[model samples]
Target: MKHLTRLATAALMTTSLATFAQAGGHANWTSVADQSSIAFGSIKKDTVGEVHHFEDVIGTVSEAGELAVSIQLGSVETYIDIRNERMIEHVFRAADAKATLAGEVDMEELDALGVGETTLTDFEGVLSLGGLEADIEAELLVARLSEDRVLVTTANMIMLSTADLGIDAGIDTLMKLAKLPGITRVTPVTVRMVFEK
Candidate 1:
């Protein structure tokens, strides 16, 4: 009976190891950069709004469920080359800016997501840009596209203030360069990210 008990214990240990490995593997994810986008809307004159997007946004999810995204400041696209250049030089100071965002999510919550199901969750993180960091709180829509793929997107617009990031002076410079009477200090941003195992 003691021998049988030892054999059962050994089998249980093997099963536990396999389960842990599978769980670890599932938590590691790589971003599909070509399929992801980060877009923002800026208002000029407190009325005219224009939508712009970044061409180079990359992200990754670690096995421990930490998510980090790096956005190329110089990749800002405003549908016009001249405007894009202006934004990079004046507003973002692309040459010296480090734009990164990071956050953590419960891996267990993600692991419980079933294929074809969507879950709404709160994502809390920090957005670091132009030598300043601000706490970020946004709603996220997480969809399990497949066993090896997942999609995460902003469920609502996140508003950011230029003053909060010490970029208000840059906005003033842009306003002057463009001869605009006024430019709103707040911008709305969103992200659509796709990750695969």
Candidate 2:
């Protein structure tokens, strides 16, 4: 009976180790960069866009299933000193919105990712931003930076008006300056994320 008990314990240990190894192979997004560009003049000059660095990004991944991402409101970036403050404190009503981005990624379908630079096909997910949730479908681009590091980038164009986010575009001249003549329909928001295993 003692020998049988020892055999069962060994088998349990092997199973536990296997599970751990599989879990460790997964990667999670630890940081995010949100940058935007604007057209100022008739010639459409491009300038160095503002960068918002978002840390405290929390998410998990499963080797065979989908990747679930949860980003905390406290972790956000707007780059501009005054703009970031106003957007979070006033426009976003950070006090109420406390926005969080959550989404799922299919690992089985994106197996070709992490092998150099790869552009993923259209991925469908829900984005909860500025106290509202919307369905989003965008192309995902990923690159394996190293044996344990990866870089992921994606661009999502939102068609909703700024008023939806409590942002009064007509209030300040600053907001008006952001407008690009002849293009008032689509707002492209891009995210570049880096992760480590």
Best by TM-score: 1
TM-score of model 2 relative to the true fold?
0.53
**Against the correct fold, how does model 1 do in TM-score?**
0.83
TM of each candidate vs. truth:
0.83, 0.53
Q: Write the per-residue lDDT of candidate 1 for residues 124-173, one digit (tens) a residue.
A: 66666656676666676777777777777767766665666667777777
For each candidate, C-alpha RMSD in Å? 14.9, 15.5
Instruction: Please give the range of 10 consecutive residues that has the lowest summed lDDT in model 2.
Output: 35-44
User: Which pairs in model 2 have colliding backbones?
Assistant: none
Per-residue lDDT over 1-197 for candidate 2, one digit per residue giving the tens place of the 0 to 100 score? 11111111111221111122223255433332222111111111243333233333443344543444443333334545664455445444453334333334445444444446454444554445545554445554555665554555543332333433334442233344545342221233444455555
What's the lDDT for residue 4 in model 1? 13
Candidate 2 — which residues are off by over 4 angstroms?
1-59, 63-66, 70-80, 95-97, 112-114, 155-186
Clashes of each: 0, 0
Worst-scoring 10-residue span by lDDT in model 1: 1-10
Best by the lDDT measure:
1
lDDT of each: 0.59, 0.37
